[model samples]
Target chain A: MEPPDDAIPDRPARETLAHLRARIAPAEAASGPVLPLGAPPLDQRLPGGGLALGAPHEIAPEDVGDEAAALGFLLALLARRLAEGPGEALLVLAPGHPLPYGHGLLALGLDPGRLLFLEAGDDVEVFRALEAALQAGSLPAVAGLVAEGLPLVAGRRLQRAGAGTLLLILRPAGAGRPNGAATRWRIAAAPAARDGAANPRPRWRARLERCRNGRTGDWLMEWDGGAHRFDLPHGLAGRAPAAGGTPA
Target chain B: MPVALAAAGPGGLRLTAVDAGARALGLRPGEPLGRVRARVGSPLRILPAEPAADAAALERLCLWAQRYTPRVAPFGPGEDAFGLHLDVTGACHLHGGEAGLLDDLERRLAAGGIPARLALADTPGAAYALARFGAAARSHVPPGGTAAALAELPVAALRCDAATVIALKRLGLKRIGALARAPRAPLARRFGAALMMRLDQALGLRPEPLAPIPETARYGAARSFLDPVSRQETIVAVARALMGQIAPRLAAHGLGALALRLSLHRVDGAVKALDLGLASPGRCPDRVAGLLRLRLDRLGAALDAGFGFESIRLDVTAADRMPEAQGMLGAGPAEDGIADGTAALAEALGQRLGRPLLRLGGVASHLPERADRILPWRPGTGPAWSPAPLPPRPVLLLARSEPAEEVLALAPEGPPRRFRWRARLHRVAHAEGPERIAAEWWRADGPARDYYAVECEAGRRLWLYRSGPHAAERPAAWFVHGVFA
Candidate 1:
C-alpha cells in the first residue's frame, strides 16, 4: 500500500470524484450583482430590484429644457459603470459638433481625457458608429445623443455586441415606440423647491416606459454628481409623481 | 510622319517644332514657314501653334506626375516646348529600379497619347541632356558613367546656348569629348563660364541644386499595377494595402493622421482624389478603411472608376502625435483619461460624416468669442489648470452672433425684460447679473459687452449681451449669444 501511494493512502473514489468536480465544474453564471437604480421606488418596482446590466437602455428628454437632465443621467450612469474597472473608457457620440464641455464633464466626476467624442450627421451614422464602438468592446459603455427612429436591426446589433457594457441612447422626448430595447426611459427636469441657496440641487423626473419582464415605475431622481450616484432612499421613499404615472 | 508646328516669327510664320516625319523632309523648328511650305509643298500639314494651350496641358501633366514624386517641377515657364523635371532619386526604388521606373513612365505616357522621353543620372543636367539629344533618346546614365556617356555626344548635349554651340562647332569642336580635350584656358576664354558650369554640373563635378515642390504630406505610400484595374473592389483593395504599408511608419513615429488623401491614378491620365479627415488622430488602418467605405458609398455617382486606376497613392496630409494607448503595463486605464478605442471611433465617424468634429474647452478670457476655444488634447500640450474664478457660460454658442430684434430693457440699462430672437418674442421671467467682458485690444477693436443670463417665460435660458453702453452717444445694440441647458 505504501509503494502504491508513495507517501499516503489513496483517497476514496467518491471523495476524489467530488473534489475533481469542485475544481473543474464551471463557475456560476455571470449574474454577479444587479446595478441598483438608486431610487428606492424605482428599484422596488423592478423584479430584479435594480437596473439590469449588459442591456440597452434609452434615456430621452421631454423637450429642449429637459435635455440637460437626460444627458446628466447618462453621464452619471457611465461614470459609475466605467469606475468599476480601472482605466475603463466611454465613447460619446453626439449630433453636430456641440460637444459637452470638459469642465462640465469634470463637474460630473468624469475625466475629459477619458471621453472620446464623435459627431453623427444623422441617425444612420449614429447607429453605425455606435455598432462599431460596441463591437470594439474596449469601452465599458458608449453614449449616443441622437434623435430617435433607430431601426430594430440596429438595436439588435447593439444588444449582441454589448456583452458587459451599457449601451445608452439619448434622444429627444417622443412617443415611447418599440425599438427592441431592454428598457426605455423618459427623463425631464424636476425643479426643486426654491431655497435661500444660490444654486439649488438639480433633480429629474425619470419614467420607465418599457422594461422586458420588469416592473415599470417613475420617481423624482436627485443626482449626487460628486459621488456619481443618485441619492437612494431607504424604505422606498420615492413615490410616483402626482401626475398619471406608470400603472402599479 | 513628318510633323512641324508653325508659330508667328519676325519674318512671318515659322516652324517651332518638327517631328521625325517632318525632319525627314528637311523641315525643322526655326525654319521660315515659307521655306518649309516650299520644301514640303502640299504634302506638309501646316497648323497654327497655341503656346497657351500647350502650357496648360503641360501644367496638368506636371500635377499628374506628382504620383511619381512630389519633387516634380517645370523646367521652363509657359513658353517654348516645356519639359518636366522629377527628382526621382529616392522615389524610383519603389518602382523596382531606375530602368523599371522609366519604362513604366514611358508606357503610361504613351497610353495617355502623349509622347515622352526619360533619362536618369546623378545630375539633373546630365539627365536632361541624355533625354533630349542622346542617340538612344531615352537612357539611364550610371553614377560614374556621366563623363563617358556625355563625351561622345554632340556638344549640343552640354546644354550650351545656340550661339555657343555654333562657336564651338566653328572651332571644329563638334563633339563634347573634343571640347573636353581642348585648351582649358582658351575654352573658358572663348566659351565663357556658363559652358564650364554646365559641363561641371553634367559630370557631377559640381552640385546642381534642384528646388523640389512643397509637399503637404510627409508620409505616403504608392503601389503600381502590372495591369490596370478598374473594379471598385480592386481600387479599394489597393487603397487598403497602401494604408497598411503607411500605418507602420506613422506608428513608429508615434503619430496619427488628422487627414488623408487617396489619389487614384487612372489609366486615362486623370487623377481622382478622396480626402478623409479625423476628428481625433489615430493609427488604425481598419477604422480608416471603414470611413473610406462610408465616403465611397456617399460618393455614388461622383466617383467614376473610369478605364481603371494604374496606380494608387495614400498620403497622410495632416497628422498629430498619438502615443500608444494606456494599459500597456499595469497602470490601469483610470490613470489615462481618454478611453482606449475612442480615437478609432472618432476617426471612423469623421470619415463617414464630413469634416473634423471636436469638443471645445473654454479658456479664461475677457472676450466672449475668445473665451470659447477649440482645445487640442495631445501629448506634451495639455489644458492649463486655471484657478481663476469665472462666470458661468452656456454649453452651446451660436456659430455667429445674430442681432436680437426689438430689445426692451426693464430699466434702460437693466437686464432685458422682453426681446425678439429669430422672429420669436420671449418674455423674461428671471434675470441674472450683468457680467461685463471687455473686447481684446490686440484683436479687432469692438465695443464692450454686458452679458446677462436671462430665463425666459418659456423656460429657455438665454445668454444675451448688450454691445456698447446704454448711455453711449448712440443706442446700444443687443445680440443673443448662446443658450444654456
Candidate 2:
C-alpha cells in the first residue's frame, strides 16, 4: 500500500528546494557523525555516511506483529551508536515500557549500566527531554518509544536540537506518516530460520520509507546479535525484494 | 498574655511567680496568701503549679516554634523567666517581617488553645524585656531600635538577679532610661561586673545568645500561609517554595542535604510529616523536586491534606560534607555518578515505581530462589552484573516454584526423562547439568537441591530441581523453577 512516488500529501504547503535539500543534506549532522547501517546499498544511499547523529530517526514496525523485529533493528542502531561514541550513555525515554531484558540487551553488546530509563508523563515532555538532551550533546543517543504517532510539530521541534546527539523515536507499526525527520524506516518481522526455536535472532524486512538525500528502497536486515551488527539476510545482498511480505 | 508558673514559696502558694497573666490581673508575685484569702482567694480554686511540668511545657512550646526556625529554646536560663528564644535570623522573613512573625506565632498558639507573648529584637536581652513587660503581649523592635526599646523598660526588665535590681534601685536608677547615660567605670565599680554585664547585654554592647537544643537544624526554612491550604497541589507548591529557601542555606553551609524532613502543620491541629532519605546528597532544584515527587508518589491518595496546612517547614535533618556531584568535564558524568542530570531519571523511575526498575539480579547464596532477588536499580547500587563465562540463565523466573506431578524418569536420583508442570508434560529433548545448590545452614533449615536445565520438545527451556538426596526415602520432589526465553 505504498503511495505513488510523486503523490502529494493532503496538507501540501510551500516548500523550497533549498529547504528540501537541507533536509537531506544535514550539513552539521552529516560531518561523518552517522552510525552506518553496514548494508552497502543502504549505506551508499544515506547522506553523511550513515544515520545522522543529532537527528531524530523515526522507525515503525511494518506490521503489528513485527514489533520484535523493529525492536531488534532499534537495538542494533543503538549498539552502533554507543560503539561509535564510546564512554557515552544511552538515555531511553520509555515511560512505561516493559523492563528491558538484560540478557537480550547484553547479547547486543550494550552494557546494562550504560542504559538509563527516563519516565516522562506525556508526549510533550518526552520530546522536550529528548530535545534538551540532544541540544546538551552529552549523551551519545536519546531514544523514545511512543505507541501513538507524534504530531509533525513535535517531530520538527525535536529536529532543531538534533545536531550532535541522535534522537531515535520508535512508534508503533502502521502508525507513521511523513514528518520532519531526516530519515523514516518501516521494519517487519520475518520468519525465523528455524521455526519455534527458543530465542532465535529475529529477522526484518526494513523499508526506507523516506530519506532526506538518500534513495528509498527495501532491504532485509537480520540481527547478527552476538556479532552486534545488522546484516543482509543470507540470500539477499544488493538484490531486489523477494515476493512474500507486503511493504507498508 | 503570658501563662505564669506559680508555686509555694515561704507563703502558702500565693502568686509565687506571676507572668503577664497575674501582672495583667494587677497581682504581683510573692504576695501573701493571707491577703489573697481575704480578697478573692476562696473562689480562685488554685492548683499548685509544678516548675518541672512548666519547664516541660515550655520545652514543648519551643519544639512547636521550631517549625519557624530550627534554633528554638528557652530565652535564658531560670533567671530569664518562662519565655521562648527563636534564632530566626533568616527564617523570620518567610513569615513576612518581625511583626508578621509575631502575628503568625500568636495566631497559631492561640489556635492551639495556648496563650503566648512574643518579642523580636536585635538582642536577646531586649527581646526578653519586651516579651515579659513591654506593656503589650507582642512587641517587635526594628533593627537599631533596641536602645529606644530598652530605655523605657524598668531595671527589673534587664534579666539581672533580684539582689542586683534592689541594689540598683538604691542608686536611684529605677528605670533603664535613668541608667543609660551612667559612666560604665563608676557603674562597674559600684554594681560589679554582673550588673554591668547585664546592662551591656541588654543594650547590645555585649553578645547575649541563646543555646538552642542540639537537634536543631542549622539550615531550615518555613512558610506560614495567610490562609490554610487543603489541596495537595498547594501543599506541594509550599513545599517547593520552602525547598527553594532551604537550598541556598545549604549552599551557604558548603554542604548538601542527604536527608530532609518536610513537616506540615495542618489547620486541624495535626502535624503530618514526610522524611526523605536520598541515596546521594544534592541541592539541585530539579533533583530535589524529583526525589520529592518520588516520595509524594508513595503517599498518593493516602495523603489527606485535611482542613489545610497552615505552615510548611523543611528541615535538613542530615547534611553531607561534600557538595553535589556534577558533570565537571564535557565528556559528562559516568553512569555511576548519576549527578549530571542523568542520575535523577534513574532515581525518579525507581521512586515513582516504588521499587527498582531492573530485574532480579543474582545474590551470592547457593539457594535456588534465594540466589536471585529483585533489587531496585539505583545509580550506584547492588552487585555489578557481569555476564557469566558459562551458559546464561533464564530471563523469566517463576515467583514460586510449582511442584511437578507424575514425573517419569529412569532413576529417582537422575534428571527427569519427562515432567508434567501445570498439567502440561514436557519431554526432555536435551538435558544440561545437575548443578548442586545448597541453602545456608544457620539461615534456614532447608533441603539441598540438584538443579537441572532441560529443553522440551517444544523448544522451551525449563529449570527443574529435585529436593533432598535420592535413594533411601520416598522419591524426591521435583519442581519447575524457571522458564528461559
Best by TM-score, which number? Answer: 1
Per-residue lDDT tens digits of candidate 1, residues A1-248? 23666334345766788887887654323342456756566677654666565567888876755676677677777777666665444444545436655554554556555555666667777777777667766667777777665457878877777766677888776635678777777777554322454433345667776776666666667655456677633343566544444556
- Give candidate 2's error at residue B55 in angstroms: 8.3
Model 1 misplaced stretches (Cα beyond 4 Å): A1-39, A43-55, A68-97, A100-115, A174-176, A192-198, A232-237, A241-248, B1-72, B75-77, B81-271, B274-303, B306-340, B375-391, B398-434, B440-481
In candidate 1 the C-alpha lDDT for residue B365 amounts to: 63
lDDT of 2 by residue, B244-316 (tens): 7877777766677777788888888888888776656766555566567767766787778877788888888
Best by DockQ: 1
Residues B1-485, candidate 1: write the lDDT tens digits.
45678989889999888777788888868899987777678877777899899878877787788889878877742112468788897898888888888888998998998877788888887777777777785888877898788888888877777898899899999988787787888889887898988888878888977765546546899999888887666667777787788887887888877778988898889999898876566656665677678788667778887777888888998888776776656765221113435455545455555534354455666765665456543322234434322345554567678899788886878898998988889888877768887876776677778888777765556679998786657678999887654
For model 2, what is the alpha-carbon lDDT of residue B436? 77
User: Following a full C-alpha superposition, what root-mean-square deviation does model 2 have from the true structure?
Assistant: 19.0
In model 1, the clashing pairs are: A87-B333, A87-B334, A113-B337, A113-B338, A114-B337, A114-B338, B1-B21, B2-B21, B2-B22
